[model samples]
Target: MEFKRTNMCGELRSQDIGKSVVLMGWVGKKRNLGSLVFIDLRDKTGITQIVVREEDKDNYKKAREISQEYVIEVKGSVRERESKNSEIPTGDIEIVADKINILDSANTPPIYIKDDDDVSENLKLKYRYLDMRKPSVQKNLKLRSDIIRTAREYMYEHGFTEVETPFLTKPTPEGARDYVVPSRINEGKFYALPQSPQLLKQILMIGSLDRYFQVVKCFRDEDLRANRQPEFTQLDLEMSFANQDDVIEMNEGLIKELFDKYTDYDLELPIARMDYKEAMDSYGSDKPDLRYGYKIQNVSEIFKDSDFKVFSDNTLEGRSVRAINFKNLADKYSRKQLDKLTDFVKDYGLKGLSYIKYQEEIQSSIKKFLTDDILEKLKEALNLEDNDLVLIGADKDKTVLEGMGALRRKVAKDNDLYEKEYALCWVVNFPMFEYSEEEGRYVSQHHPFTMPNEEDIDLLLTEPGKVRTQAYDIVINGDEMGGGSVRINNSDLQEKVFEALNLTEEDIKNKFGFFIEALKYGTPPHAGLAYGLDRLIMLFAKTENIKDVIAFPKTQSATCPLSEAPSPIDDRALNELSIKLDKE
Candidate 1:
């Protein structure tokens, strides 16, 4: 603590040899070689080798006692390493210690501070501070900071003003369940965390902010997935007087800048755009992975007169019979593997998966039910070839699309069919509303604020299911990086949308009264988008687990093992909020 540090552990090089320097970091590793001690000192930048000899008896004693992760400062002279390490930048030089100060000693860590340390995720989360010392983990955090800085630079360059919205506000009607906080000041009342700054940003547009952006946190009380967390960060932005084209163009430029800065891949301007309907019809997913091709082909017409009940019955009932041609994988999937695929589709509500193996001759589970004419039509429709396998899903359109979409990704991964380093596309013209069987009513697909397409506005009342909105999503590979829509600026249009969603007048007043009132005061035509900052970092870092990019993420059950959050509070605190726990 007495000596001021002059350099980071990882910053020294052979060029700086013979210069005396002071460095501070953790003891990454240590070894005693007879009268000499060798240590690898590590900091956030990287690691550097430190040498101490018995000639400096006091410092050598201290160095020999230094253990992994021990905090220390060293006054040393830089010298060329006897054997250079080509793997690291600081590998060419070593630090010869004149003095060693053990600032703080550390107990052996529960988890190793190495990238390849195989440990349970729960244990890693519990010992996150130690896990974060790994170079790989630190790299992700540094990259995340760089990405945020780049995003802010781009936003400012585009005349966007950065603004912060409230974290605690009233709960909105649609979207995922909110994580509400009991308001002690208001007694029984509660304040819900913002899901995205969706309504608030729209309000900003109404207030003539012109352009706004925020790197903010969002929360949702929803089931967790590999790529999702209950609490996450997003780069939320909105623009006044902007239509769908204006929003899309501005965002495309931002995306180009981000990729150009963080990745070697140069993105083409005006990225390819696909309609939602077309994406679903071809790839069976709105967020289609365009890196590989195993497009879903509709064979409903080809099976119209077939004796196969699964296909014929589905077609007659206005359902679909779709197939994916996994070319040259016919021999790869055995009967057991095919049965596993059937079970996979079952998860998506499909009764079963039917497949045809085209090897030397036709081999299939339902070939006996198909006549020669029907078989020939199917072969022609799917463009069958030798060693081609065709997997079929016959069910309602939604079920078929979901099942085939999952299968397509699995097949691509199993066969190593990725054809590009990055595949980015925009999905547009999404449905305005979809019927919710659970609620027995129509609900907004994106949100109630999304503006319906001009041509489809008339169908909002009569055929809400068929109406398309000016909504769009940016999809990278197979993940939906982010999505947004043009907002309805007119108060009348907003009311009509609420009515179409079956929101009673009282319900509207309770959930969106202020938003509607703001629309009445000269709200401009606006559109906005929010990108999942975590997902973006994952893509840039080339990591599969979302937790790897996050600093302190929760487990799948939404519990933080490190801090043990969402734990019971003192009775006095709950009593002050006029709340009581309900007995199970």
Candidate 2:
């Protein structure tokens, strides 16, 4: 018999009543009585109920034999369901089967094919093809597609040309480690996957592409975390003769469109901006969630003259104290719970945690150490009220901010303190260089090509640590959604940035030789940004697990459960590539 789908299972509704429709999908489930059978047919869109009555003997017989996940085609007339299911989209209508074709049968699946199945991630990933059939999973993938299409369409309308850069390119000097592929004919040489197309995009600007964009794959052979993968997609973009303002302006439209299309919040254009230093000082995070009002407050002055040595010592130069008020959560946290909070900050390098319970009677961890005068001052600084809990961290500025910032976020999450669903802002004016303690040198905060602020350019060599870059990041709900910086178009300035990193002439020639050469060929003042496509989708999809947004994501250990990827290659294939395993 000929098989063709006249309509999707989920799209049929009461309006299509009495219309003959051909539907092909997997059997979501089957309910069989002695006379009748009701089967829920599922496609990627959704599930629709199909009724096979005893009167239609042949169809009823075939439907009765159907089991879960069995692929089948049905010829039926749409009819209003007497019993409506408010839960599903196609609940109002169902097909009354006249003909049925059981195309294939499926054995019991390893995992249930349903949303909210609550199976372990490994099992879901192992049977990813089946997992994707779930409506919830399919919706995320669909949203991912919509976002990419929106981005592409926006770029095209804005005169940006989509260009495909090579996947196998030279490794960059800055950022994460690269995933390298060994070359067969080139003996020991290898090709490192492009980390961000950072150099290539700038080279395009030099080549006068003017406006370039790529939905590119980037690989990083670094330690994987929950949201991070060994390989990920980047919405890579760059523009020539553009500054930070131009880049941000153009991107704001696309970002606004995405938010406006996907979210209910009315996002205002030219989204608010916060300086990097201000963000760190105010929230202890470069990417701060502005949805709530637990802003980090500097309380160093409150303990400046205190007898407590810990508070006084940190209140000195290069050290400081900070605090956050968990509004009305004081009595809620017991001593043991407070101890747990203390244990949490230890990972951030705090020796201890100090907190105040501003209840009927003011109680504090440092009650014995501080005079009542200092306590009063601290209360004033944090705007103390009844039932308030103030958590304080005192150390060097970096340690205090980071520790307190982390505590701030943790408290908000633990106590259900988030006031809004989405909070976004532009974090601008990042430091040009950050000192890497392990490397014992300054590295680019964004990348080597980042152009320093006009005034800060003079401070680049003299006060490299203080120099600010013309860089910006679009931070959404405390995640760095996307970031970019103006490129150092002049070859001499580019070489100087390398010099500031203490790179030897040989290091410069080998690592960035081609990029430096490209800069010499009339490079334009270009800037670009790349969004973590997966993270963006995860945010809009409202899923905390990044794997929820990816189709076949790898585990935190960077291995794919579906294909058993990273499996060993045959020894003959290894030999052909001139590779040998040390296994040491």
Q: What are the runs in model 1 whose C-alpha is more than 4 Å off?
A: none
TM-score of each: 0.99, 0.98
Q: Best lDDT goes to which candidate?
A: 1
* Clash totals for all candidate models: 0, 0
- Model 2 ranges with Cα > 4 A deviation: none
Best by TM-score: 1
